[model samples]
Target: MADDSDLPQVVNRPGGATVGEQFRELLEARELIGFLAVRDLKSRYKQTVFGLAWAVLQPLIGAAVFLVLMTRVVGVDTDPVPYLLYVFVGFVAWTYFQASFTSASEVFTRNTDLITKVYFARLASPIAALVPGLVSVVVGLAVLVPMLLAYQRSPGWPIVTLPLWLLALFVATLGPALMASALLVRYRDLRQVVGLGLQTMLFVTPVVYDASGIEGGVRWLYYANPLAGVLAGLRWSTIAAAGPPTEAALSLGVAVVLVAVGMFVFRRFERTFADVI
Candidate 1:
């Protein structure tokens, strides 16, 4: 028999990868990400009779509830944009944020088998969860495209800045996702806390209502919240209206700070993940 030991081995590596090297390695692992993403999609809607319809249906239902509350109960003013569009934009953005956070928190725990056996980057687990949410966000955006066209609303030059806004949103939400996922390995209660906190934040955020609706001390607190910029940008993009510039800037700045801290924390804790998780 030929000496098989001479064959070049493709051993999988894990952490200690520089950010740039991690990204390149991640790109090389695209097939793994795709497989996990498809598995997640299938598992999420698996037993449900509605299947993929759950994607559109869940957000639509959420928007309807918000529309009723904003228009009837609170009587919040929506500028040129219809209440449906206003709520839909916030709901969709928030959905992506919340989904990313919750999914990321359990990444290490859920992928223990793969992590224990595989040679791929540990970052892949959290990154893979993002794929399903990204698909949902794109599908959700497509649903809005027709509505915008029907309304004859022109997004104007302001729409060009969307890429920046999206980057801000990604980091704002992803900070918590990375932080929470890393922490959850040690403290499981963090997951429940994150879930409840996100729910509370939804009411406080300018999602169903405009920022003008907040007043007094509450207004300052809202501006301090990292989600303020993302929510404002979502409204600006879909409604073609500008939010309070100063508050939006502050919010975006805070999000950047949070992301920095989150990155530091995640890196610090990552070494122990294999042991704890």
Candidate 2:
């Protein structure tokens, strides 16, 4: 996987390139993107005792802890739905986001040697950063089916929209991910900030609790966070829970804006990445 013989050496000079052209470089460098993604996946799991098991186990353990705390101690009410099942679905989605985001944020810093020496579209770095997390999310979903059956639950009609939900989540994640990855090229401390921000984001995003649980005007908080609607959509498509939140549209808009800003910011600094790094 470390082999870069086939990797494109095309320099990604920002110059007067429009944002669309710079972003399009991501598509144009498809082979390089795939190569980087595979290299990243190998790098992440290489030489580990448990290897990829860490990906599966990390979310499982997180869900179990949340289940105990939310179910036994706090007694978070999911009603006919078992708290474990409810939380696991949410955990899987969060794991995808957090894992992808953390990796994307560090793409530049971690690939200093490559960026400083080679010539390839840096956008490939962020796009590649996103691929490996899907391994965990897909495995989590496979594990979810049996639990759903044990609970005598199924995904229902909304399951057909699962891919759509995943696409939306991916698009939404691209916002911070691109911004974080691009900014970290210059501000190395941003690595620590991205981790802390995501940690604080979990509680606010409703991963361990249902979005519907929040009532009254305060509910606006849920709609304000982009992850809320994406998570809600994931739950709706996977678990066939209550329909998506009333303000799901608002969250989607927020996500779109984040992506736009992230791209703008990333491009603004793109020309300087190689020299600065």
Candidate 3:
């Protein structure tokens, strides 16, 4: 029998990993990634009476509240489509982005012990954090289908573009998530700021209202929010609403740039995460 003590140890040198090397490491750690994702899913639903129902319930409840407040009370217009269906689609996409961003932002701080003790790729944490939210979004969609059917509406041919729209959403959120997670290692107060920012962003986005309502210079500023384009594209894809294709395309381009910059920033700072955490 071979002695365990005879095994050679691996050493990781500081600033030794290039972007390619890091991605290779991430690929090699795919099993760990899946495990962490499953762990997150189990931990989130563990001991909860509702379990996965919470995913569907949350958006359903929100849609109900907004349906009353926007349609019945305030009378916000969602012409050509039922108000409930319109807002529900927005909620589905928004909920996914919000949850993914929030989870990714706290990936490092939440798993301080694991990062400090383990030798896995640091990127895996944020990447794995995305899985639970993706699951929730899919579950939310199951609830959405019945609502659409009840309203006598269908997503139409545009629905084929859904995968592309989802990819854009992921890219848009990943940039911010990477930046936030990197900063969180050194600044704990950022968690609160991130929460507040997401709340503020909800109103600014076209989640409850139409982007077409904002005209002139103000409209340009509104489209500046990367999520604006993502939500608009999603709404167009799912409900066939009159979303601004040109603006969505431009914003998606911006999101790609943000992803590049964020990756640079994350990789630059990742070497220091072990010490900071």
Candidate 4:
């Protein structure tokens, strides 16, 4: 038998870790993230009878309802991009945002067993929360191109930029998610507040309508939301004829600031999770 002195030593850092340390842990714990992501997928969909089909249907059903409303009741205008495709793309992108937010909020609350018992990369939980719904988003986008062909529409030259827009969507989502997850560990009530905030964000994000439809002076405010730019990019990438992403610079700037602030808040709160959580 090996002597206790010869055993591997695990460094214990209470409170929280530094940024570089956190990054290293996250990199080292990529497998943990994958495992957590799979667990999330199972708990979210597989446990249910319909399984992942529910994931696919939820967005489609919501989009269908909104499509009827936007085209009929409100008579909303989304020129160049067909109203059908516009609503579908917007719903798909928004679904991932909603999922990421909810998942992030529960990162600690859902894993109290692990958080209290073991030492691993706490950061991985929030990052993994962003993954499970991504499959639905990918499926939605893949389905869109075929829909366009069915409708006799062309994706045009803008299709090449689709990857950038998809990347932007994940970028826009990750920071807020991490921040939300950390905050929830201390303030569980924030779950409802954050959920309400997301609902407000959905209406504000031009998902059911176009930014051009808004009044000019206040349109800049709408562009300040990073998801607005991302949503615009998604629309443009898939529709080709859709309007350019307005105020692209301002939205990108806001996204960077959001990421910085979220990281700051998350790091500040993470140190106390094992205690208060």
TM-score for all predictions?
Answer: 0.82, 0.90, 0.91, 0.91
| lDDT (tens digit, per residue) of candidate 3 on 1-277 | 4787878545568675877788888898999889999999998999689999989888878889999999888989889878887788788878888888888888888878877887788888887888788888778877877877787778888888888887888888888888888888888988889889999989888888877767677666677788889888787777768755466666787788888888888888888888888
Candidate maximizing lDDT: 2
* lDDT for each residue of candidate 2 in 141-202, tens digit (9 for 90 to 100): 88889889888988889999988888888888899998998888888877778778988899
lDDT of 1 by residue, 1-277 (tens): 3897988545335655466666677788888888888889889878789876666776778999978877999887787678888888788778888877788778887768765676676666776787788667667767888888888886777777776777777778777777887888888877678878888988778767777666687676688887877878766765686654567787887888887787777777876776786
lDDT computed for candidate 4:
0.82
TM-score of 3: 0.91
lDDT-sorted candidate list, best first: 2, 3, 4, 1
When 2 and 4 are scored with TM-score, the better candidate is 4
**Any residue pairs clashing in model 2, and if so which?**
none
Question: What's the number of clashes in each of the models?
Answer: 0, 0, 0, 1
Better of 1 and 3 by lDDT: 3
Instruction: Tell me the whole-model lDDT of each prediction, alpha carbons only.
Output: 0.76, 0.83, 0.82, 0.82
